[model samples]
Target: MSTTTSPSKHLLELQGVHTHIGAYHILHGVDLVVPRGELTLLLGRNGAGKTTTLRTIMGLWQASQGSLRFDGRDISRLHTPQIAGLNIAYVPENMGIFADLTVKENMLLAARQARTVAQIDEARLQWIFGLFPAVQKFWNHPAGKLSGGQKQMLAVSRAIVEPRQLLIIDEPSKGLAPVMINNMIDAFAQLKASGVTILLVEQNIHFAKRLGDSVAVMDNGRVVHAGRMAELAADEALQRSLLGLAL
Candidate 1:
């Protein structure tokens, strides 16, 4: 007799997603699933459409085909803000900080958009500060003045200020020093420990191998391999074929 496995505990799923940027079609048909309380990493070489997949999921760009399901409900074509309102947060590569605004102000902007903003609670703010003390220290400084790592922290903090079902992040370690990357990884780990589901698009294989609960490898806009993190890390030849990297 065979036992059937249950659906994921968390609430994010992408099925046969196809996306196009301008005249170019990037994701021919991609499928992704992220369980709650797990860190799911999407990995690929440059131009593999890793970031584009995140955009399509966030509804920044409409999907020409397939379904995006959150909490077992279909949300394939919802507006961007609408998707955000459903407790899914997105932090893109640029970090989207307000250059002229102070660190506190940028957070405040995100706070106001949250359902609990009217209450002005500091619990989440305090938690954010605890996760990234640098933000607390730079509260009064313009967000533009922060280092690359600090800005990435601020972006992530802002995205998660609200209670979210899914947090989608793009290239959190991109363009950061070794120390900053470590800091970001620690932050992500902390987030995972809190039982928040994360779907990340990352290029750093080492980082992905360390934090990813499951790995999805993409190539030419298609996901070529999906498996356990340890399986990929242990196979050298698979790494070369999928990522063009020996390690």
Candidate 2:
């Protein structure tokens, strides 16, 4: 006889989470969930505490109160590096690429298991190149020299340099041309199909609706609505009420 264990339905969960930045309370009891192998979108207007929530989850900002659980373990008290060590990757709104370094060097730095370019897994690197051709095209070029869309691609490619259990991305499609945004949407769809859980803070309603399996709308530091993306996408009245615009 043999027995097997089952994985948790939710890969990441934040319950009643609160955060304060120098006496300014940000997250007001944020409750969000990222289901295993699904893409969850965090949507809201400016100053809605969307980025703050992502920062808190990544341990960049400590949650003053409440619980954050990752794969059934408490992570509210963990430090930034420690949280990242659990195979979680975060790409902030700024993209966070090393501008001074060559694209190849930046990628090499992201690969923890590889000390040199030659040591990186060839197959995986090729797969990333396929996902973002600009990263390959600018392999030896300084990251700062690339266009905005290229930089965003490089940032995402760097995050997936090694296998990640979860990806927390902030506005991957920001400041891009329509063509580039569509390209990004395609890349993200492929990434979702590859089985990594994703949490995104996106202002692009089209991108969010296209790729999100679940949706959470935040306002004034609180999550005002949470449900299936399709349900929200189909309901214009609810969208206007929660997001102040129809999707």
The worst-scoring run of ten residues by lDDT in candidate 1 lies at 112-121
Q: How accurate is candidate 1 locally (lDDT)?
A: 0.86
lDDT of 2 by residue, 61-148 (tens): 9999999999998999999999999999999999999999999999999999999999999999999999999999999999999999
Task: Tell me how candidate 2 scores on lDDT.
Answer: 0.96
- Candidate 2 worst ten-residue window by lDDT: 4-13
Cα-based lDDT at residue 211, candidate 2: 96
Residue 128, candidate 1: how far off, in angstroms?
Answer: 1.2
Off by over 4 Å in 1: 1-7, 113-119
Tell how far residue 13 is off in model 1, in angstroms: 1.6
* TM-score list, all predictions: 0.92, 0.98
For residues 119-206, what per-residue lDDT tens digits would candidate 1 score against the true structure?
A: 5467877888888899889988999999888899999988887777789999999898988888888888989999889999887776
Q: Which candidate leads in TM-score?
A: 2
